[model samples]
Each structure stands twice: as C-alpha cells, then as structure tokens.
Target: MSSSAGTSTQGEPLNATALNRQLKVMQDRINQLEAQLQAGSGAPRAKAGEGTPKERKRVKLSAPREFDGQQAALAGFLIQMQAYLHFYEDQFASEFEKVTYAGTRLVDKALTWFEPILKDYYENGDQATDFTKKVLNSYADFTEALSRVFGEKDEARRAQERLTHLRQTKMHFAATSTTTG
Candidate 1:
C-alpha cells in the first residue's frame, strides 16, 4: 500500500502527530511554570518599599480551648477579689500598726470570699495562675498580697527552680564557649 496524506470527512487536515506534539509542548510549559511557582524560584520581583513586607507581630500562646471560658470568668473574679483583698489587707496592716481592730472582721470576710475561688483555680486542669491583670496597680497589690499571705510554698519552689535554671544556663554557656574555642 502507498502512503498518502489524508484529510477527514470535513476536508480538514488530520495531523494527529502535529496536534499531539503541540499539546505535549503546552503541557510541558504549564508544568515548568507550576514547578517554578511552587519552588518560589522564578517569580516576578517586587518593588522595594512599595511591596516590602512588614514585620509580623508575634502571636500569644494560648492554653487549650477547654479552659477559655472558665479562664476569662476566673480572671474577672480574681481582679474584683484582688482589689477588695488589697484594700482590706492594707487597712488591716495600718490598723495593726496602730493596734486597732478596725476592718479586722472585714479582712476575715474577704478571705472567706477568696477561699472558694482559689480552690477552684488550683483544681482546674491547667494551673495558669497569672490572672487579674487589667489594672496594673491592683494586680501588683494582689500579687504582693499573694506572696505575703498565700504563695509561700509556690514562691520558694519558684526561687529554687530559678536558681537551678541559672546554674544550668551558666554551665551550658561555659561548655559551649570551650567547645567553640
């Protein structure tokens, strides 16, 4: 049989080979473009300062979602309690200095209010104790009171942990310096 170039019924050229080659070239070009974009290697350059990226703000680390609602309510309650506790504690301190019993009963009453809140806080799964931070003065007063009245065991443990951490850090730095040198 003789080889002949044939046209289809519609009189159009039936160049299957040419169509396949063109399709393959187009596919290769598309794949190459995709690869470049994926690799971030051949993208269009951005104008300096015009499209310059801003430094991203650091995200605060959050506790597990389970504690979100309880934590917020606990924080508000703590703030309110802290303010009253501080006022009374200060009043008591002043009165004691003057050998007066004024506000003594009020201070005891305040302590009673705080007992359940503290118990629940310690019992919660995540012991995230730093709360009541809305008012700086109040928070500071509360923290001071906590250390004075309630945080003895925690304060001692924290101090000991800090000392150990400092010692370990010093040793690490010294070892690293020796190795590098």
Candidate 2:
C-alpha cells in the first residue's frame, strides 16, 4: 500500500487532509487578491509621515467641510434611504436564491422600475426635503403594491408605511411648533 498525496497509484483515493490543505491555500490566495483589489492601488499603506510632502499635504487638504443643520439632515436622510435600498436589494437577492428564475426576473423588473427614482435622488441635492418625501412616499407605494401582488401582509411593507407616516407627522409637528412656540 502506497500513500502518495497527489496521484493515486494503485487506484487509491486522494487524501482528504491533502485536499483540505490545498483548498485552504487557495482560499488564502483568494483573500490576498481580494484585499489587494479593495486597496485600489494594491500597495501597502504607508506609515504616518512616511509619504512625500505632496501626498501628506493632499491628505490634509481632503478634510470634509462642516455641514449646517439642513444639509446635515438631508445627508442623514439620503444615507437612510440608501441603506433601505440596500436592504431591499439583499432581500431580493435572497428571494432569487430561494425561488424560480421567473420569480427573480419579476423582482428584477420591479427594481428596474424603481431605479430611476433612486438615480434622480442621487443626482439632485437641491430640494432635498421634497425629494426625500417623494422617495419615502414612493417606497411606501411600492411596498403596498408588492403586498397586494404577493397576496399577504408583509411586515417590511407595513414598516415602510409607518416610517412614511411618522416622517410626515414629524414634519408637520416641526412646522406647527415653530409657528406656535
């Protein structure tokens, strides 16, 4: 009986330990490549004060400007909307994995219909409040339509409706509170 790791000489099976070790090596290499790709330049990060004066100056000059209340609020709303869209994307991806191709395609089509509104929001910074309101309203409508299509009450759909309602209530309160008090 021969115990060769790579090739089976006498019709023997390959060793599981050797196979797992090889897989581990491949996975390590894949991780390294992914790290390099994410780093953009594939270069190791330099220590502080190690880079050229020009590079250091560039980094120092890239500090973000301070935002006022309205701008900050708008930025927060944009970030929240983006997060919600990403959550929907993850949900659709999970659904695609579990369901048939046709079902996945239907979801893709629905997302396609909503894509333009997301793009518009991304492109325009002016009218941020109005755009956010529109986005929330549209998302609520989409969820309602989705619930109707699925023939079931969806918790996420209901949550979106509640969020929209709460936002409106908050806006109204703020407006009235400013005038009255």
Candidate 3:
C-alpha cells in the first residue's frame, strides 16, 4: 500500500533501508527459532510413557558396604562392588581407579588381604608387573584374587550335592514318562 510496505515487483529494486528492515525481520525470526530450539519448546513433546527418547539418568548408588571376608557376604559384596564400578564406569577411567575404589571398600580380613597388594603397588608405582602390582592394577585380577582367598570353602561338596539332586530329579522325570513302543 505504502512505499515502506513489502517488496516491490516488476523489476523494482528495494532501497537500503527496506533491505535492512527485511534483514532485521529475518534475523529476528531466526533468533526466535534459535531460542525455541534452545528452550526445547519447538519440537512436539511426547506424553508420559511415550517413546520420546531421553538421556539415561545416572543414578547415585550408595557405596557398597565394607567387606570383612565373611564367606556369605563375599558374593553379595563383590556384586555390589561390580554394580558400583559398572554404574560409575565413567568416573573410573582406568583399571587403577576401579581396583583402588574396590580396595577401599574392604575392611577387617578383606582389608588385610588387600593391604599387601596395595603396599606393593604403591611401592612399585605402576601396576603392570606380573606380581602383586598386577593384581592391584587389574579389576579382573583383583576380583579373582578375592574369590580365591574367600570363595566357598565347601564348593566341591556343594557342587556334588547339586549333581546328586539333579540326578534324582532326572530319574523321577524319566520314570513318569511312559514310553509308547
């Protein structure tokens, strides 16, 4: 309607002021879109229990209870330690960090067992050696050491008992099945 209205057609050129005004409008629209994107309001939001993917939350797990080498608690203690290490894997970037954290969770008899390895590693600097330092540096080695030192004392008896029970169960099932021949 007026000269300062929209763009002119029929080979009409836009003056600098109109061009600047159009640029300002475009820049303002761009700023609005950017703000909307940053605020997470531009995309349609999914309802509760919907399939909008979300970042996995990092749950803060309580520290594992101290392990005092009780045979019963050993398995549970190791499980807790493993869960702790797995959940906080990013925090423990190296095997040293993982093993050291596990070592700190030990107490009493467990602490006693870990002390020698800790001392050796600290005294030797790196944990790459095939000795005590190796155990201190590797999570797998450390867990294996713990299992060997504190695993079920009557493991053979327990396994044999399970096998005997399994054999009896198999015999019962075989007896119940009538063969048609």
Candidate 4:
C-alpha cells in the first residue's frame, strides 16, 4: 500500500500542525460543554457578593456574639455580624441562608422577636409578611429592619430632648443646708 497523507473530511490533508490545532479545539469544546452541563444540573450557585465555596478563605473566624433586643447594642451587633459574614461569606449560598443565620445568632428577646419573622418567611414562602419578604430577598433589608426595631434612634432622640432642656437650677444664697447665723 502507498503511504497516504492525512486527509481531512474536505479531502484536504492535515499536516501535524493543523491536526494538533483541530484536536486542541475539540478538547476545548468538550471542556466548555462539560462546564455548562455541571452548571445547569441544579447545582447551588453562590450569591453575587459571595464567591464560590471552594474559593473561600479558610481563616480562623470569631463569629458574632448573640444579640439581645437592646437598642444600644444594635450597632455593635451589626458590625460584628458584617465582619463575621465577610470572613465566611461562601458558607451561605443564598440570601435566605444569611438571614436565617443572623436569626440564629439572636438570643432572649431578640430571638423571640425573630421567631415570628422566621416563621412567616418559612411557612409563607415568597408571600411572607412585607418585612419578612424583604429580608428573605436581601440581607441588607433584613439588617435594616432589624435596626429599625432594635436601633438607638428613639433613645438618641430622647437624650437629645433632655439635653435641649438642660439648665442650671436657680438657688437662693440664704437657703443653706448648714446652720448659719
């Protein structure tokens, strides 16, 4: 038999360079399709702000402390929660997960307050109470609602009022507590 050149489907003989290029192209296409298939197979996707789980930093984390329903403590709780979430963001795959997590960190009066909100969200699904619906859709909404409920705005206002009305009392010089002649 005579030695034959590498003939492609179009009767064009593929040299070593051309054949290698075609193989590489086929391999790249297979990888691309495989990735799409994996992505479409109901796999959980990370939230926009959170990167994929595998990419998460595995650092020592100190979680936020439990928050009781105290207006003065709300700011510190939010800051701690934000820092903790930042470190372990990939652990949560959805907005609901994050909201639920924050709920789990509540204690005493705060937990009591959150129970109904959590229930409304879980039992009602997408049709939960307005605040619950907002929180379920976004972590920011949840924190904002939490702040409104347990924030120091009212306390600050009351303190402001007291400060505005502050004045030195007028004391009579003759009216002394000690015996005087």
Deviation in Å, model 2, residue 136 alpha carbon: 3.1
Q: Which tens-of-lDDT digit does each residue in 56-175 have in candidate 3?
A: 334579999999998889899999999989877878989988999998999999999989777776676764357687676689989988998998868999899988887343434334
* lDDT tens digits by residue: candidate 4, 1-181: 1133466667777788877877787799888878877888644556655885565544587778889998778889999998988777878898878888998899988888889988887798877878777876788998988887888668788999999998858964675487778
Q: Which regions of candidate 2 deviate over 4 angstroms?
A: 1-107, 126-132, 137-139, 145-181
- TM of each candidate vs. truth: 0.21, 0.19, 0.64, 0.54
Candidate 3 lowest-lDDT run of ten: 50-59
lDDT (0 to 1) per candidate? 0.44, 0.46, 0.80, 0.80
The Cα error of candidate 4 at residue 169, in Å, is: 24
Candidate 3 regions exceeding 4 Å error are 1-19, 22-57, 126-129, 164-181
Q: Which one wins on TM-score?
A: 3
Q: What does each candidate score in C-alpha RMSD?
A: 21.8, 23.0, 6.7, 13.6
lDDT of 1 by residue, 1-181 (tens): 1123455456666688755766677799999999998898996556554452343333333211221123224344345444544444544454222112211222343445445544544475244354422112243544344334433446578888888887343434334434554
Q: What is the per-residue lDDT of model 2 for residues 1-181, given as tens digits with 9 covering 90 to 100? A: 2345454566667687766776687799999888887987765666788888555533222212221223224344334444544544544454322222212223243445444544555576454456333443454443334334343346689788888887343434334435555
